[model samples]
Target: MKTKRGKIPGFAIQEMMVVLAITAIVVGMAFSVLNLVQRQMGSIEDIYEVKLEANKLRQSLWIDFNRYSYVNFDERKGQLYFSNELEEKNYTIIEDMIFTEKDTFNVQLEHKAFYFKNHEKKIGEIDAIELKTSKESGHQQIFVFKDNAPATYINHKP
Candidate 1:
Protein backbone atom coordinates (compact mmCIF):
# COMPACT_ATOMS: atom_id res chain seq x y z
CA MET A 1 0.00 0.00 0.00
CA LYS A 2 1.34 3.45 -0.97
CA THR A 3 1.40 5.70 2.06
CA LYS A 4 0.77 9.40 1.64
CA ARG A 5 2.44 11.81 4.05
CA GLY A 6 1.37 15.43 3.67
CA LYS A 7 0.42 16.93 7.00
CA ILE A 8 -2.21 14.25 7.52
CA PRO A 9 -1.03 13.86 11.19
CA GLY A 10 -0.89 10.09 10.94
CA PHE A 11 1.72 7.46 11.79
CA ALA A 12 2.51 4.32 9.80
CA ILE A 13 2.38 0.81 11.32
CA GLN A 14 6.18 0.54 11.35
CA GLU A 15 6.55 3.87 13.14
CA MET A 16 3.92 2.91 15.72
CA MET A 17 5.64 -0.42 16.37
CA VAL A 18 8.99 1.35 16.80
CA VAL A 19 7.50 3.80 19.28
CA LEU A 20 5.84 0.99 21.25
CA ALA A 21 9.10 -0.94 21.34
CA ILE A 22 11.00 2.07 22.68
CA THR A 23 8.34 2.68 25.31
CA ALA A 24 8.47 -0.92 26.41
CA ILE A 25 12.25 -0.76 26.67
CA VAL A 26 12.14 2.39 28.76
CA VAL A 27 9.49 0.93 31.09
CA GLY A 28 11.48 -2.25 31.51
CA MET A 29 14.60 -0.32 32.42
CA ALA A 30 12.66 1.76 34.93
CA PHE A 31 11.26 -1.34 36.59
CA SER A 32 14.68 -2.92 36.85
CA VAL A 33 16.10 0.22 38.42
CA LEU A 34 13.22 0.33 40.86
CA ASN A 35 13.85 -3.25 41.83
CA LEU A 36 17.52 -2.49 42.53
CA VAL A 37 16.59 0.50 44.64
CA GLN A 38 14.13 -1.61 46.62
CA ARG A 39 16.79 -4.20 47.29
CA GLN A 40 19.20 -1.53 48.54
CA MET A 41 16.52 -0.13 50.82
CA GLY A 42 15.90 -3.58 52.27
CA SER A 43 19.61 -3.98 52.91
CA ILE A 44 19.71 -0.64 54.70
CA GLU A 45 16.77 -1.63 56.87
CA ASP A 46 18.45 -4.87 57.84
CA ILE A 47 21.61 -3.01 58.83
CA TYR A 48 19.60 -0.56 60.88
CA GLU A 49 17.85 -3.37 62.68
CA VAL A 50 21.20 -4.99 63.47
CA LYS A 51 22.59 -1.72 64.83
CA LEU A 52 19.56 -1.28 67.09
CA GLU A 53 19.94 -4.77 68.44
CA ALA A 54 23.62 -4.19 69.15
CA ASN A 55 22.81 -1.03 71.11
CA LYS A 56 20.14 -2.82 73.08
CA LEU A 57 22.50 -5.64 73.91
CA ARG A 58 25.21 -3.26 75.05
CA GLN A 59 22.87 -1.22 77.25
CA SER A 60 21.25 -4.28 78.76
CA LEU A 61 24.58 -5.88 79.50
CA TRP A 62 25.85 -2.71 81.13
CA ILE A 63 22.82 -2.47 83.39
CA ASP A 64 22.90 -6.14 84.31
CA PHE A 65 26.61 -6.11 85.03
CA ASN A 66 26.28 -3.05 87.24
CA ARG A 67 23.17 -3.97 89.15
CA TYR A 68 24.24 -7.52 89.92
CA SER A 69 27.26 -8.46 91.94
CA TYR A 70 28.13 -11.38 89.65
CA VAL A 71 27.49 -12.55 86.11
CA ASN A 72 28.07 -15.86 84.38
CA PHE A 73 27.19 -17.62 81.18
CA ASP A 74 25.91 -21.18 81.11
CA GLU A 75 27.38 -22.63 77.94
CA ARG A 76 25.33 -25.80 77.97
CA LYS A 77 22.04 -23.95 78.28
CA GLY A 78 23.09 -20.91 76.21
CA GLN A 79 21.94 -18.65 79.01
CA LEU A 80 23.64 -15.69 80.67
CA TYR A 81 22.66 -15.27 84.31
CA PHE A 82 23.43 -12.46 86.71
CA SER A 83 22.93 -12.71 90.43
CA ASN A 84 23.84 -11.28 93.79
CA GLU A 85 22.91 -12.39 97.33
CA LEU A 86 19.14 -12.25 96.81
CA GLU A 87 17.88 -11.63 93.28
CA GLU A 88 18.83 -13.49 90.11
CA LYS A 89 18.22 -12.53 86.51
CA ASN A 90 18.86 -14.59 83.37
CA TYR A 91 18.80 -14.35 79.61
CA THR A 92 18.94 -17.19 77.12
CA ILE A 93 20.07 -17.12 73.52
CA ILE A 94 18.02 -19.49 71.41
CA GLU A 95 18.13 -20.03 67.65
CA ASP A 96 20.02 -16.79 67.05
CA MET A 97 17.63 -14.86 69.24
CA ILE A 98 17.78 -13.50 72.80
CA PHE A 99 15.14 -14.22 75.44
CA THR A 100 14.97 -12.77 78.90
CA GLU A 101 13.29 -13.67 82.16
CA LYS A 102 10.40 -11.88 83.89
CA ASP A 103 8.71 -10.52 80.76
CA THR A 104 9.91 -13.15 78.22
CA PHE A 105 11.33 -10.35 76.11
CA ASN A 106 12.91 -11.49 72.86
CA VAL A 107 15.23 -10.04 70.22
CA GLN A 108 16.10 -11.55 66.88
CA LEU A 109 19.86 -11.55 66.37
CA GLU A 110 21.50 -13.62 63.70
CA HIS A 111 24.94 -15.16 64.23
CA LYS A 112 25.21 -13.88 67.78
CA ALA A 113 27.97 -14.97 70.14
CA PHE A 114 28.97 -14.10 73.69
CA TYR A 115 32.38 -14.74 75.25
CA PHE A 116 33.16 -14.28 78.93
CA LYS A 117 36.22 -13.90 81.11
CA ASN A 118 36.11 -15.44 84.55
CA HIS A 119 38.31 -15.18 87.62
CA GLU A 120 40.41 -18.07 86.36
CA LYS A 121 41.76 -15.90 83.58
CA LYS A 122 45.24 -14.48 83.96
CA ILE A 123 43.75 -11.01 83.88
CA GLY A 124 43.22 -11.51 87.68
CA GLU A 125 39.47 -10.97 87.70
CA ILE A 126 36.28 -12.01 85.96
CA ASP A 127 35.36 -8.69 84.43
CA ALA A 128 35.18 -8.76 80.67
CA ILE A 129 32.72 -9.97 78.05
CA GLU A 130 32.57 -9.98 74.28
CA LEU A 131 29.44 -9.86 72.18
CA LYS A 132 29.32 -10.32 68.43
CA THR A 133 26.35 -10.11 66.09
CA SER A 134 26.04 -10.40 62.33
CA LYS A 135 23.37 -10.41 59.69
CA GLU A 136 22.93 -11.94 56.24
CA SER A 137 23.38 -8.55 54.71
CA GLY A 138 27.03 -8.57 55.77
CA HIS A 139 26.45 -6.34 58.78
CA GLN A 140 28.62 -7.30 61.73
CA GLN A 141 29.29 -5.72 65.13
CA ILE A 142 31.39 -6.68 68.10
CA PHE A 143 31.02 -5.17 71.58
CA VAL A 144 33.49 -5.79 74.36
CA PHE A 145 32.71 -5.32 78.05
CA LYS A 146 35.57 -4.29 80.31
CA ASP A 147 35.95 -4.90 83.99
CA ASN A 148 34.63 -1.86 85.74
CA ALA A 149 33.19 -3.41 88.88
CA PRO A 150 35.19 -3.21 92.07
CA ALA A 151 36.79 -6.65 92.21
CA THR A 152 33.43 -8.36 91.70
CA TYR A 153 32.60 -11.57 89.88
CA ILE A 154 29.19 -13.17 90.09
CA ASN A 155 28.64 -16.92 90.35
CA HIS A 156 26.78 -19.00 87.82
CA LYS A 157 23.46 -20.56 88.68
CA PRO A 158 23.28 -24.30 89.22
Candidate 2:
Protein backbone atom coordinates (compact mmCIF):
# COMPACT_ATOMS: atom_id res chain seq x y z
CA MET A 1 0.00 0.00 0.00
CA LYS A 2 1.20 3.59 -0.74
CA THR A 3 0.00 6.97 0.63
CA LYS A 4 -0.84 10.13 -1.32
CA ARG A 5 1.80 11.98 0.78
CA GLY A 6 4.40 9.54 -0.72
CA LYS A 7 6.37 9.11 2.57
CA ILE A 8 3.86 8.02 5.27
CA PRO A 9 1.71 4.90 4.83
CA GLY A 10 -2.03 5.00 5.71
CA PHE A 11 -5.03 2.67 5.68
CA ALA A 12 -6.26 1.59 2.24
CA ILE A 13 -9.82 2.40 1.01
CA GLN A 14 -10.81 -1.32 1.37
CA GLU A 15 -9.62 -1.40 4.99
CA MET A 16 -11.51 1.81 5.86
CA MET A 17 -14.72 0.43 4.35
CA VAL A 18 -14.34 -2.79 6.36
CA VAL A 19 -13.93 -0.88 9.63
CA LEU A 20 -16.96 1.32 8.89
CA ALA A 21 -19.10 -1.68 8.07
CA ILE A 22 -18.14 -3.41 11.31
CA THR A 23 -18.84 -0.26 13.34
CA ALA A 24 -22.26 0.09 11.74
CA ILE A 25 -23.10 -3.53 12.53
CA VAL A 26 -22.06 -3.18 16.17
CA VAL A 27 -24.01 0.04 16.56
CA GLY A 28 -27.08 -1.56 15.00
CA MET A 29 -26.89 -4.51 17.41
CA ALA A 30 -26.55 -2.19 20.40
CA PHE A 31 -29.61 -0.23 19.34
CA SER A 32 -31.63 -3.44 18.94
CA VAL A 33 -30.67 -4.61 22.43
CA LEU A 34 -31.56 -1.22 23.89
CA ASN A 35 -34.92 -1.29 22.17
CA LEU A 36 -35.67 -4.73 23.59
CA VAL A 37 -34.73 -3.61 27.10
CA GLN A 38 -36.90 -0.49 26.85
CA ARG A 39 -39.96 -2.53 25.85
CA GLN A 40 -39.41 -4.97 28.72
CA MET A 41 -39.13 -2.12 31.21
CA GLY A 42 -42.39 -0.65 29.97
CA SER A 43 -44.22 -3.92 30.56
CA ILE A 44 -42.66 -4.32 33.98
CA GLU A 45 -43.74 -0.79 34.90
CA ASP A 46 -47.33 -1.60 34.01
CA ILE A 47 -47.28 -4.73 36.17
CA TYR A 48 -45.88 -2.73 39.08
CA GLU A 49 -48.67 -0.18 38.73
CA VAL A 50 -51.29 -2.90 38.90
CA LYS A 51 -49.66 -4.43 41.96
CA LEU A 52 -49.43 -1.04 43.66
CA GLU A 53 -53.12 -0.40 43.22
CA ALA A 54 -53.94 -3.79 44.68
CA ASN A 55 -51.73 -3.19 47.68
CA LYS A 56 -53.28 0.19 48.39
CA LEU A 57 -56.73 -1.30 48.37
CA ARG A 58 -55.68 -4.13 50.65
CA GLN A 59 -53.96 -1.88 53.19
CA SER A 60 -56.87 0.51 53.43
CA LEU A 61 -59.32 -2.30 54.06
CA TRP A 62 -57.04 -3.93 56.59
CA ILE A 63 -56.63 -0.74 58.57
CA ASP A 64 -60.35 -0.10 58.68
CA PHE A 65 -61.14 -3.69 59.62
CA ASN A 66 -58.73 -3.63 62.52
CA ARG A 67 -59.62 -0.17 63.82
CA TYR A 68 -63.40 -0.44 63.86
CA SER A 69 -65.36 -2.35 66.48
CA TYR A 70 -68.54 -2.64 64.47
CA VAL A 71 -68.98 -3.41 60.76
CA ASN A 72 -72.19 -3.41 58.77
CA PHE A 73 -73.14 -3.60 55.14
CA ASP A 74 -76.33 -2.82 53.26
CA GLU A 75 -76.37 -5.00 50.20
CA ARG A 76 -79.21 -3.21 48.49
CA LYS A 77 -77.66 0.20 48.95
CA GLY A 78 -74.10 -1.01 48.24
CA GLN A 79 -72.86 0.70 51.38
CA LEU A 80 -70.47 -0.55 54.05
CA TYR A 81 -70.22 1.14 57.43
CA PHE A 82 -67.47 0.83 60.04
CA SER A 83 -67.92 2.38 63.45
CA ASN A 84 -66.19 2.58 66.80
CA GLU A 85 -67.04 4.65 69.90
CA LEU A 86 -65.86 7.99 68.54
CA GLU A 87 -66.05 8.14 64.75
CA GLU A 88 -67.59 6.28 61.86
CA LYS A 89 -66.33 5.44 58.39
CA ASN A 90 -68.32 4.56 55.29
CA TYR A 91 -67.37 2.83 52.07
CA THR A 92 -69.58 2.82 49.00
CA ILE A 93 -69.27 0.35 46.18
CA ILE A 94 -70.60 1.12 42.72
CA GLU A 95 -69.89 -0.95 39.65
CA ASP A 96 -66.14 -1.67 39.50
CA MET A 97 -65.06 1.02 41.96
CA ILE A 98 -64.89 1.45 45.74
CA PHE A 99 -65.21 4.93 47.25
CA THR A 100 -64.15 6.11 50.69
CA GLU A 101 -64.32 9.53 52.27
CA LYS A 102 -60.63 10.12 51.46
CA ASP A 103 -60.00 8.21 48.21
CA THR A 104 -61.51 6.04 45.54
CA PHE A 105 -60.12 2.67 44.48
CA ASN A 106 -60.60 1.40 40.93
CA VAL A 107 -61.03 -2.28 41.61
CA GLN A 108 -62.90 -4.62 39.34
CA LEU A 109 -64.69 -7.06 41.60
CA GLU A 110 -65.42 -10.59 40.54
CA HIS A 111 -67.18 -11.50 43.80
CA LYS A 112 -67.71 -10.38 47.41
CA ALA A 113 -68.67 -12.28 50.53
CA PHE A 114 -69.45 -11.18 54.06
CA TYR A 115 -69.37 -13.28 57.20
CA PHE A 116 -70.32 -12.90 60.85
CA LYS A 117 -68.83 -15.39 63.32
CA ASN A 118 -67.95 -17.74 60.45
CA HIS A 119 -71.53 -17.70 59.20
CA GLU A 120 -72.23 -16.14 55.82
CA LYS A 121 -74.56 -13.18 55.78
CA LYS A 122 -76.26 -11.36 52.95
CA ILE A 123 -76.93 -7.93 54.46
CA GLY A 124 -76.17 -6.56 57.92
CA GLU A 125 -73.45 -6.77 60.54
CA ILE A 126 -70.31 -8.61 59.52
CA ASP A 127 -66.94 -9.47 61.01
CA ALA A 128 -65.13 -10.52 57.86
CA ILE A 129 -65.20 -9.68 54.18
CA GLU A 130 -63.73 -11.40 51.15
CA LEU A 131 -63.23 -9.64 47.88
CA LYS A 132 -62.26 -11.29 44.62
CA THR A 133 -60.86 -8.73 42.23
CA SER A 134 -60.00 -9.02 38.57
CA LYS A 135 -56.81 -7.54 37.08
CA GLU A 136 -55.09 -7.56 33.74
CA SER A 137 -52.54 -10.14 34.88
CA GLY A 138 -54.89 -12.40 36.87
CA HIS A 139 -57.46 -12.64 39.67
CA GLN A 140 -56.69 -11.74 43.29
CA GLN A 141 -58.50 -12.38 46.57
CA ILE A 142 -58.37 -9.95 49.48
CA PHE A 143 -59.75 -10.71 52.94
CA VAL A 144 -60.11 -8.30 55.83
CA PHE A 145 -61.25 -9.45 59.26
CA LYS A 146 -62.15 -7.99 62.61
CA ASP A 147 -60.68 -10.05 65.45
CA ASN A 148 -63.41 -9.69 68.05
CA ALA A 149 -66.73 -7.95 68.06
CA PRO A 150 -67.51 -5.62 70.95
CA ALA A 151 -70.00 -7.03 73.48
CA THR A 152 -72.44 -4.19 72.92
CA TYR A 153 -72.19 -4.62 69.15
CA ILE A 154 -72.78 -8.36 69.32
CA ASN A 155 -75.61 -7.92 71.78
CA HIS A 156 -77.36 -5.08 69.98
CA LYS A 157 -80.32 -5.93 67.77
CA PRO A 158 -80.50 -4.17 64.44
Candidate 3:
Protein backbone atom coordinates (compact mmCIF):
# COMPACT_ATOMS: atom_id res chain seq x y z
CA MET A 1 0.00 0.00 0.00
CA LYS A 2 1.11 3.59 -0.59
CA THR A 3 -0.20 6.90 0.69
CA LYS A 4 0.73 10.58 0.36
CA ARG A 5 2.38 12.18 3.37
CA GLY A 6 -0.71 14.34 4.28
CA LYS A 7 -3.46 11.70 3.52
CA ILE A 8 -5.23 9.70 6.27
CA PRO A 9 -5.32 5.89 5.94
CA GLY A 10 -8.73 4.21 5.32
CA PHE A 11 -9.87 0.92 6.88
CA ALA A 12 -9.06 -2.19 4.80
CA ILE A 13 -12.01 -4.19 3.38
CA GLN A 14 -11.31 -7.14 5.73
CA GLU A 15 -11.21 -4.90 8.80
CA MET A 16 -14.45 -3.17 7.79
CA MET A 17 -16.21 -6.46 7.27
CA VAL A 18 -15.01 -7.73 10.68
CA VAL A 19 -16.28 -4.58 12.42
CA LEU A 20 -19.69 -4.90 10.72
CA ALA A 21 -19.96 -8.56 11.76
CA ILE A 22 -19.14 -7.71 15.39
CA THR A 23 -21.76 -4.94 15.39
CA ALA A 24 -24.36 -7.32 14.01
CA ILE A 25 -23.61 -9.91 16.71
CA VAL A 26 -23.85 -7.35 19.47
CA VAL A 27 -27.15 -6.04 18.10
CA GLY A 28 -28.57 -9.54 17.82
CA MET A 29 -27.62 -10.32 21.43
CA ALA A 30 -29.15 -7.08 22.64
CA PHE A 31 -32.42 -7.88 20.89
CA SER A 32 -32.46 -11.38 22.38
CA VAL A 33 -32.01 -9.98 25.91
CA LEU A 34 -34.77 -7.48 25.33
CA ASN A 35 -37.12 -10.20 24.17
CA LEU A 36 -36.37 -12.32 27.23
CA VAL A 37 -36.95 -9.35 29.55
CA GLN A 38 -40.27 -8.61 27.87
CA ARG A 39 -41.44 -12.18 28.36
CA GLN A 40 -40.50 -12.13 32.06
CA MET A 41 -42.29 -8.81 32.51
CA GLY A 42 -45.44 -10.25 30.97
CA SER A 43 -45.42 -13.15 33.45
CA ILE A 44 -44.89 -10.81 36.37
CA GLU A 45 -47.78 -8.65 35.23
CA ASP A 46 -50.09 -11.66 35.12
CA ILE A 47 -49.11 -12.68 38.65
CA TYR A 48 -49.66 -9.13 39.89
CA GLU A 49 -53.13 -9.06 38.37
CA VAL A 50 -54.08 -12.31 40.08
CA LYS A 51 -52.81 -11.13 43.45
CA LEU A 52 -54.59 -7.79 43.10
CA GLU A 53 -57.89 -9.43 42.33
CA ALA A 54 -57.50 -11.82 45.24
CA ASN A 55 -56.83 -8.94 47.62
CA LYS A 56 -59.88 -7.08 46.38
CA LEU A 57 -62.02 -10.14 46.97
CA ARG A 58 -60.68 -10.59 50.50
CA GLN A 59 -61.35 -6.97 51.43
CA SER A 60 -64.88 -7.02 50.06
CA LEU A 61 -65.77 -10.21 51.88
CA TRP A 62 -64.37 -8.87 55.16
CA ILE A 63 -66.51 -5.78 54.94
CA ASP A 64 -69.68 -7.67 54.08
CA PHE A 65 -69.10 -10.32 56.74
CA ASN A 66 -68.85 -7.67 59.42
CA ARG A 67 -71.79 -5.64 58.19
CA TYR A 68 -74.31 -8.43 57.95
CA SER A 69 -76.19 -9.62 61.04
CA TYR A 70 -77.13 -12.92 59.46
CA VAL A 71 -75.24 -15.15 56.98
CA ASN A 72 -76.65 -18.16 55.18
CA PHE A 73 -75.16 -20.53 52.64
CA ASP A 74 -77.14 -22.35 49.98
CA GLU A 75 -75.18 -25.38 48.84
CA ARG A 76 -77.51 -26.21 45.99
CA LYS A 77 -77.24 -22.75 44.48
CA GLY A 78 -73.59 -22.10 45.39
CA GLN A 79 -74.56 -18.85 47.08
CA LEU A 80 -73.97 -16.95 50.27
CA TYR A 81 -76.68 -14.59 51.51
CA PHE A 82 -75.85 -11.80 53.85
CA SER A 83 -78.59 -9.70 55.36
CA ASN A 84 -79.02 -6.87 57.82
CA GLU A 85 -82.12 -5.02 58.95
CA LEU A 86 -82.12 -2.73 55.91
CA GLU A 87 -80.37 -4.55 53.08
CA GLU A 88 -79.43 -7.91 51.66
CA LYS A 89 -76.35 -9.03 49.69
CA ASN A 90 -75.76 -12.18 47.74
CA TYR A 91 -72.47 -13.72 46.66
CA THR A 92 -72.73 -16.48 44.13
CA ILE A 93 -69.84 -18.69 43.12
CA ILE A 94 -70.07 -19.99 39.58
CA GLU A 95 -67.22 -21.82 37.89
CA ASP A 96 -64.11 -19.67 38.27
CA MET A 97 -65.79 -16.41 39.22
CA ILE A 98 -67.73 -14.85 42.10
CA PHE A 99 -70.72 -12.58 41.49
CA THR A 100 -71.98 -10.22 44.16
CA GLU A 101 -74.91 -7.87 44.12
CA LYS A 102 -72.90 -5.00 42.65
CA ASP A 103 -69.55 -6.42 41.54
CA THR A 104 -67.92 -9.52 40.13
CA PHE A 105 -64.64 -11.03 41.32
CA ASN A 106 -62.64 -12.99 38.78
CA VAL A 107 -61.08 -15.41 41.21
CA GLN A 108 -60.66 -19.11 40.61
CA LEU A 109 -61.40 -21.13 43.72
CA GLU A 110 -59.69 -24.43 44.36
CA HIS A 111 -61.52 -25.06 47.62
CA LYS A 112 -64.24 -23.42 49.72
CA ALA A 113 -65.88 -24.11 53.06
CA PHE A 114 -68.34 -22.42 55.41
CA TYR A 115 -68.09 -22.58 59.16
CA PHE A 116 -69.97 -21.46 62.22
CA LYS A 117 -68.41 -21.73 65.69
CA ASN A 118 -65.54 -23.74 64.21
CA HIS A 119 -67.87 -26.36 62.82
CA GLU A 120 -68.23 -26.73 59.07
CA LYS A 121 -71.75 -26.29 57.71
CA LYS A 122 -73.08 -26.87 54.25
CA ILE A 123 -76.45 -25.17 54.41
CA GLY A 124 -78.13 -22.46 56.53
CA GLU A 125 -76.62 -19.88 58.86
CA ILE A 126 -72.83 -19.56 59.10
CA ASP A 127 -70.46 -17.11 60.68
CA ALA A 128 -67.18 -17.87 58.94
CA ILE A 129 -65.84 -18.76 55.51
CA GLU A 130 -62.62 -20.30 54.21
CA LEU A 131 -61.59 -20.43 50.60
CA LYS A 132 -58.52 -21.23 48.57
CA THR A 133 -57.71 -19.64 45.25
CA SER A 134 -56.40 -21.61 42.28
CA LYS A 135 -52.74 -22.58 41.89
CA GLU A 136 -52.21 -20.08 39.11
CA SER A 137 -53.31 -17.35 41.55
CA GLY A 138 -50.69 -18.45 44.09
CA HIS A 139 -52.89 -20.86 46.03
CA GLN A 140 -53.87 -18.12 48.44
CA GLN A 141 -56.10 -19.06 51.36
CA ILE A 142 -58.64 -16.52 52.60
CA PHE A 143 -60.69 -16.82 55.76
CA VAL A 144 -63.39 -14.41 56.88
CA PHE A 145 -65.12 -14.60 60.25
CA LYS A 146 -67.87 -12.66 61.97
CA ASP A 147 -67.47 -13.00 65.72
CA ASN A 148 -70.58 -11.19 66.84
CA ALA A 149 -74.15 -11.93 65.93
CA PRO A 150 -77.28 -10.28 67.24
CA ALA A 151 -79.37 -12.28 69.69
CA THR A 152 -82.30 -12.15 67.31
CA TYR A 153 -80.20 -13.52 64.48
CA ILE A 154 -78.80 -16.31 66.62
CA ASN A 155 -82.24 -17.29 67.79
CA HIS A 156 -83.90 -17.01 64.41
CA LYS A 157 -83.59 -19.49 61.57
CA PRO A 158 -83.05 -18.66 57.92
TM-score of each: 0.60, 0.86, 0.90
Compose the digit string of candidate 1's lDDT tens values, residues 68-129: 87666666777777777889888787655677764332344454444444333322223456
Q: Candidate 2 lDDT (Cα, whole model)?
A: 0.86
**Would you list the C-alpha lDDT of every candidate in the order shown?**
0.63, 0.86, 0.90
Candidate 3 lDDT tens digits, 54-121: 99999999999999888899999999999999999999997699999789989999999998777899
Global Cα lDDT for candidate 1: 0.63
How far is 154's C-alpha from truth in model 3 (Å)? Answer: 4.6
TM-score of 2: 0.86
Models sorted by lDDT, best on top: 3, 2, 1
Q: What does candidate 3 score in Cα RMSD to the true structure?
A: 3.3
lDDT of 2 by residue, 1-158 (tens): 87566567799999999999999999999999999999999999988877777678889989998898889999999999999999999999876889999988887888899998788888988889998888662367889888875594558675
Q: Candidate 3, after superposition: displacement of residue 14 in Å?
A: 1.2
- Show where candidate 2 strays beyond 4 Å: 1-5, 150-158
The stretch of ten residues in a row with the least summed lDDT in candidate 1 is 118-127
- Candidate 1 or 3, higher lDDT? 3
Leading candidate by TM-score: 3
- Could you give the C-alpha RMSD of every candidate to the true structure, in order shown? 7.0, 3.6, 3.3
